[model samples]
Target: MTAKQELKKSIIASVWFMFLTFPIMVIKVNTVTHTIDWRWHNMALVGIGSFFLSMLWRYLLKKKEEGGKKDKKAGLSFIQRLLQEKQFALPGILIITLITILFPHIFSMYQTNIMTSALIFVVLGLGLNIVIGLAGLLVLGYAAFFAVGAYSYALLNLHYGVGFWIALPIGGILAALFGILLGYPVLRLRGDYLAIVTLGFGEIIRLVLENWNEFSFGPSGIKNIPKPGFFGIEMSMQTTTIYVFYIVVLLVVFTIFVINRLKNSRIGRAWVALKDDEIASQAMGIDKAKTKLRAFALGATWAGMAGVVFAAKTTFINPASFTLWESVIILCTVVLGGMGSIAGVIAGALLLILLPEYMRDFGEFRMITFGAVLILMMIFRPGGMIEDVRKTYKFEK
Candidate 1:
């Protein structure tokens, strides 16, 4: 499109946004004085911002379209080629490793804590990556399994004095069992139907936790939970914060390793097959029941582990923390990051979590900007920030 045409479209968008935002941003009411105030500046700001943003959006959309055409002609993208070749991959890996080791030392305790939370989501995103990205299963109740893990640790420690070490694996196992429980009856379902069932299942978990006073502490939540111990040594809050960062770092590495291995394994291929064509996979002698169960179980294991870490990190547990919104955020990470791509999910988690955090300084506009960013991303890049590069094999006859 010509610049003149683009300019007209942007102006139209700006007018529309100004009109839409006028009722909320431009109008303010005072209860005590029973008076009304008009904020014209807010309206002007919205108009200007929308005008510039629309232009940027169109420019990005055009660039993406052009780049897609070029990439198709070039076969493998540069990043994909680097991934396939080991020599180029090592230096990148080493640099990232060095950064990971120095992150806590370079940042503040608050920053480290925030990063730990993001890493927890990185693990969560990976877990969901298996279900949604790999097996093409829509799991709306993922945070339900997350709740299972957090509660597993909380109740175990509160009742029997079980430590973090013992509770970690237990959390994973329990979450896996929950995953199986969810996957069993839904084995035959697909698409929207599967999503609805999972959504209902998630609500069930949340409602049960909310009402089950005798079991889950009835939404009052459990608190004063202990952090992980290191060789029976007691550490200060700062030290413990750093320790938790490293622990989550290790978990992220472990999650990536295991997930990468799973992506290349036989079952991994089975999952891809199931995702591509469930009926065809069933016809190809693949057991639909078993494969779906395995996907749910294995994918949920990571959520459970992350939940355990979450409980330890926050030293608290509540049904509110594992609500549907939390699950949505987790799902967004996988979807926004590029499903089936580890690096993408990690980047998504960091961007979604950390960016909003840093944006807190924007006050009320923080969420506004965040939501706008998401909308732009969905419009411009539906496949995610980094799409999963499919593996190709050559056959000789």
Candidate 2:
């Protein structure tokens, strides 16, 4: 589309979005007086911000398109080509690793904790990328598997005295089993219907955990969850944070490694094929049922691992923690980063998590800001912040 046409579309979308969200954005709950108040200033800011953001998006997109056309004709520059090559990338990876190792020492405890949380979501996002990004499946309830993993570890530790080491794999196995079970029933469904079923499945798991208080402790949740040990080493507050950070960093690295390997595997190619054209994939001799099942199982496996870490870190977990919103946020991370790009997933997780935490002073308006950012992202970069050029899918205009 031309720049002018894109700008016009952006303006229309901005206005429509403002109209739809005005009530929520403008109206505020008064906790002191138990009344509602209108924030006209906030509403005006949102309206103006959305318009400018839309225009900026159009401008950037036009530049990106033009750049792509130019690059095709002249090829890439030396620096660009070097960065794309593995020789440059490996040293860059080493530098990032060194920074991650020193992050806790450089930052405050609170900041370190936030980084830990972001890494957790990085793992979650990578896992979901397998299903949504690579396999092109719409799983609205991915957090269900995460909850299953957390609860598995929690209950096992509480009742059977299973430590983090044993419980971690067990939790992942259970979640994977649940993923396969969920996949079996929804094998015939696709797109919206599949999404609806998965969403319902997630809610069902949450409701079950909530109501089955005899086992799950219901809304009160499980507490006194054990922290992981360093081969039975004693853990202090500072040491615990360091341990969690290192463990999570390792998990994130492992996740990225596995995902990259999968992306290049025959199975990964089949997933992309299935994602792009299920009918054609079937005609090409791919087993649709098996492919989908593996995607679901593997995705749930990482979520399960993340759940274990979450439970250990917090030492508490409840059904409330595994809401649909969690799934949505993880999905957002995957989409915000380039869907199929591992680096993009990490960037998305860090940006989405840390950005909101740093903007906590905005209070409730921060969410509105976040929503606006997401809207802008979807409008201008539907392929995500980093586009995965290796794969292509049909896009509807």
Candidate 3:
């Protein structure tokens, strides 16, 4: 590349990184407890600054391209070549780890709490991506499995006094069973019918929690849930043990690794085929029932793990938290962030969840503004802000 082109690329990349990192830093510091007095004003400036910087960068890049001044593609240096590969995600992961470790006290407890929540939702979004994106299943009651896992942890720990560690996998097993059970009955259903059935399933789970006071404790829900301990090491404010972050980080990594593996396996190919055309998949010797069930079970298991983290972090479980709206919002994350892309799903969840948290000062208008944005997203970028690596956006005019 020419020196000018190289300089422009470096500036644009640095500015884009700034756009991403600054908001996270500002949002982390602007919580309910550490509430900055001029929080909204600062946030507005951040939004405007980020907007102009990004626009200017884009404009410069486009103008250069339009000028027909072709810059030679530079051969990558050794380090640059390594980073240019798909394994760049590893270096990014290491950088995030270093940030969390080096500046542990950069955030307050509340900020840590919200970051933990974002991590959990990231897992949830990844799990849902398996079924809805790869397998093309329309599961409206994804939170039913989430409920199953949370309630399983709550009830197992509350009544039986089981430790958080043991109850997590148990919660997962129960959710898998529920998924298989649900999948068996709905394997023949498609589209709107399948959605309706899953919707009913979510409601059924919620209503069961409501009416079954004998065990579930009804609307009162369950409390005093135990926090997770790492290898017998207890996490507390004084201990300086970043167990929550570590546990969540490990689970997120594991989920991504496993999902990526599965997405490339034989079963994964079968799922894609089934999604594309059930009849053709069946013609190719893929068993529809088994493939569908596998997708459901895998997705449910991941969500169950997320539920374990959710329960531990909150230290309380309630039916109110796993409502229909929660399921819809999760779906929105998958939809708005490019379905089938794990990284995109995480980006989508972080954006959707954190945006509202930061905009709490807007009162009722916060939701109004959010709704308008969603409508615009659907109209203008229905495939999401980022297109899948395998897909391209084609505009019909």
Candidate 4:
């Protein structure tokens, strides 16, 4: 499109947005003083911002389309070349490892804790990737499984006096079982129906915990949850934070290694087949029900493990901690990073989690900014930040 046409389109978009956001952006009601405030400046700012953003959005979109056209003619992408080529690969791996080791020591405890939390989501994103990215299943209530893990650790420690180390695996197993439980009923359902069921399932778990005071403390939540101990020794707060950071770092590495292996396994191929076409995969001798069940089970297991760590890190557990929004954020991490791509998912988790946390000064506006960024991402780059790049191999005589 010509520049003049693009400018016209942007102006139209800006006008439409101005009209749509008038009530919220251009007007404010003050009940205490019983006064109506007309914020014309807000409208002006919105118009100017949207106009420029629209233009930039169009330019990026055009660039993306052009890039897509050129991809067929191009050689291996930077990521692909770096991973497959020896010279670049070792240095890249070493750099990342060095950064990971130095992170906890270089940053403050609060930052280290934040990094730990982001890593938890990285694990969560990978788990969800199996079900959503590979199996093409829509799981809107993933946080329910997350809650299952956290509550498992909390109750186990609260009643039976189980330690974090023991409760960790137990939480994962319970979550996998819950995944199977939920998977059974939704095996036949697909698309929107499956999403609705999963969403409802999440809400049900939260409600049960909220109402069952005898079992779950009924929203009062379990408190003073002990952090993981090293050989039954109590560590100082800073030491504990550092320990948790390392533990999470190790877990992230393990998760990446396992997921990378799975991406090329026979079962992974089956999942891809199922995702591409369920009926066709079944015709090709793949068991749809079994594949779906496995996806749910494995995905939930990761969420469960992350949940155990979350409980240990926070030293508390409550239904409020695992809401639908948590599920949304986890899903967004996978999508924003690049589904079926481990590196992308990690980057997504870090960016989405850390970015929002660090922007506390923006308060509620931060969420608005977050929403805007996601919208822009979907529009300009629907495939995600780092789209999953499939590998190609050749057999020569």
Candidate 5:
């Protein structure tokens, strides 16, 4: 579309959004006086801001497209050229690594904790990436696996005095088993049917955790879960945050390494084939059942490990902690980052987690702003902030 047409469309959409959200934006509840106040100025600001921002975004997109065409005609852009050079790449990586290693020490404890949380989400996003991004599965109940992992560690520690390190692997194995169980019944399902089944499964897990008071401790949840140790040396409150930060960082790196390997392997190719066309994949000798099961298993394994870390870090977990909303947030991280891209998942997790904390001063309106940003992202860059260049599907000959 022409730039003019694009700008016009954006303006229209922004105006429509402004119209729909005006009441919510303008109206305020005064809990002190028990009265409603309408702030017309805030509504106007939102409307004007949306319109101008949309126009600016469209203009930038047009410029980028134009630049891309020119670059294709000529050669790689300067930035791309620099990236291709090993001399620049090695130093860049080293610098980034150094910064990452020192980040917890550099930042305040509160910020470090946030970074730790973001890293956990990064792990979760990477796991989901295997299922939805690589395997082309629509799993709406992914948090069920996360909860299973957390609870597994919690119960093991409570009953048998299992340490965090031992319980971590056990939790992951249990979650993988559950993933296979979920995969078995839903193997024949596809598209929306698969989504619905998975969503129901997530709810079923949560409900079980809630109602099974004797087994799970129900709504009250388990408390005082053991913290991870360094050579059995217990960490105090001040040091624990940094320790968890490093642990999560290590896990994130491991996750990225494993995912990168999987993405380039023979099984990965089969997954892409299955994702593109099941009939064609079967004709090409791909075992759909095994491939699907493996995807679910691996994905759940990462989430399960993350769950163990979460349980250890927080020292408490209840059914409320593993709600459908948690699944939605993790899914959002994947979708917002770029489904099949590891770098994108990391960036998306950081953005979603840190952005809210940065806007804490805005109080309730920060959520509104956050929602607006997501909507804009969907419209402008649905592929995510950093799209994966790799193909998610492979066509059969």
Candidate 6:
């Protein structure tokens, strides 16, 4: 192309870039009485800056073309390639993990509490990932299983005097049974139909707890549930209980690692195939009923574990705590993180849980902001932050 033509094209491109970048730079304002606050000013600045930065980068490319310089390429060494495999998130994980390990006592009590909450949510995300992400089932009532676990621990310990450790597995089994029972009837449903059924199931569970005053103690909830003890040492003391934090962290890590393994296993492959095309998978010899039940059971099993940790951590139980909203949030975590991606689910859980905790001061606006964020994420990135590709089918006739 001629120089004049190329220069004109560059000018036009730069102008269009600026036009596109303008809206991103606009700041929103909220006013109350004499006070004025900028809504999402930080986001606006970042968006605007990023746009211009991209434009400048493109302009540089055009200038390079005019100068007739060849683009350079370099082959990476073995170690360099390995290092490059380290994702942007690796450093943050390492830092957090190191801090949790190296200076357990140095941090304040609230910091520990937040870490505990985050870990519990991680477990919840892992469980839901199995159902929704892997199996492609839309579960709107995961917290029902969570409630089952918590209530099991509460009733078992309060009535039969079962210990925390003993009650944990029992609670999980109960939740799994309920999961299978629920899955049996709804295995044939999908999309909005499946979602509505799960939602009803969750509500029914909650309503039962609320109305079964004789059994559940109504809304009063069970209190003083025992936290998990360590090395036969009671967790009543703060100093020794910090060790439980590491235990929960390890559990979360192990859960994710196991989930990753299973997702790549025969069962995982079958679930993905089912997710993509139920009829095709069945034609290839996959057992439709068994696969669906497995997905429900695995997903509920994860929620059951989280429920155990949650009860152990809070030392309390109530129907209010395990509501439909909780299930929705868990669903959001799975959906926002990209279904079937372990890393994405973790990222989603962390953001969904931690962001609210950080925004607690926002009061009523917190929920509004949360909803807005969810809508924005769904609109802009429907596939979520991480995408999953199902491996080959593992079914055989």
TM-score of 5: 0.84
* For model 2, the run of ten residues with the poorest summed lDDT: 71-80
Give per-residue CA lDDT, model 5, range 324-354, as digits (tens): 9989888888989887878788888889988
Clashes of each: 0, 0, 0, 0, 0, 0
Model 2: how large is the Cα RMSD against the reference? 6.2
Clashing pairs in 3: none
Better of 1 and 6 by TM-score: 1
Off by over 4 Å in 5: 1-88, 391-397
Question: What are the C-alpha RMSDs, in order, of all predicted structures?
Answer: 3.0, 6.2, 11.8, 2.7, 4.8, 8.1
- Cα-lDDT of candidate 6: 0.80
List residue ranges in candidate 6 displaced over 4 A. Answer: 1-96, 235-237, 389-397
Better of 4 and 5 by TM-score: 4
Clashing pairs in 4: none
Show where candidate 1 strays beyond 4 Å: 1-56, 71-82, 393-397
Evaluate residue 27 in candidate 3 and report its C-alpha lDDT on the 0 to 100 scale: 55
What's the CA error at residue 81 for candidate 2, in Å? 6.1
Q: Residue 218 CA error for candidate 5 (Å)?
A: 0.8
Could you tell me how far off, in angstroms, the CA of residue 167 lies in candidate 2 after the best superposition?
Answer: 1.0
lDDT of 2 by residue, 1-397 (tens): 7868877887787788778788889888999999999888876777778888878866787776776676442543443344467678989889998999999999998999999999999999999999999999999999999999999999999999999989888988999999999999888888899999999999999999999989899999999998998889887999899889999999899998999999988999999999999999999999999999999999999999999999998999999999999999999999998788787788898999999999999899999999999998887667787666463356999
Residue-by-residue lDDT tens digits, candidate 6, 1-397:
5756655655565456555655554433345555445445554555556556655656666664554444321322233333336484598678877876865577777778887888788889889999998899999999999998888888888899887778778887888999999999998999899999999999999999988999998788889987787667645557545765776788788897889899999899999999999999999999999999998987888788778778888888889999988998889898997788787788888899989998999899999999988886775556676555444456889
Best by TM-score: 4
Could you tell me the lDDT of residue 282 within candidate 2? 100
lDDT of 5 at 376: 78
Q: Give Cα distance to truth, residue 186, candidate 3, Å.
A: 0.4
Could you estimate the TM-score for every candidate?
0.89, 0.84, 0.75, 0.91, 0.84, 0.75
Worst 10 residues of 3 by lDDT: 71-80
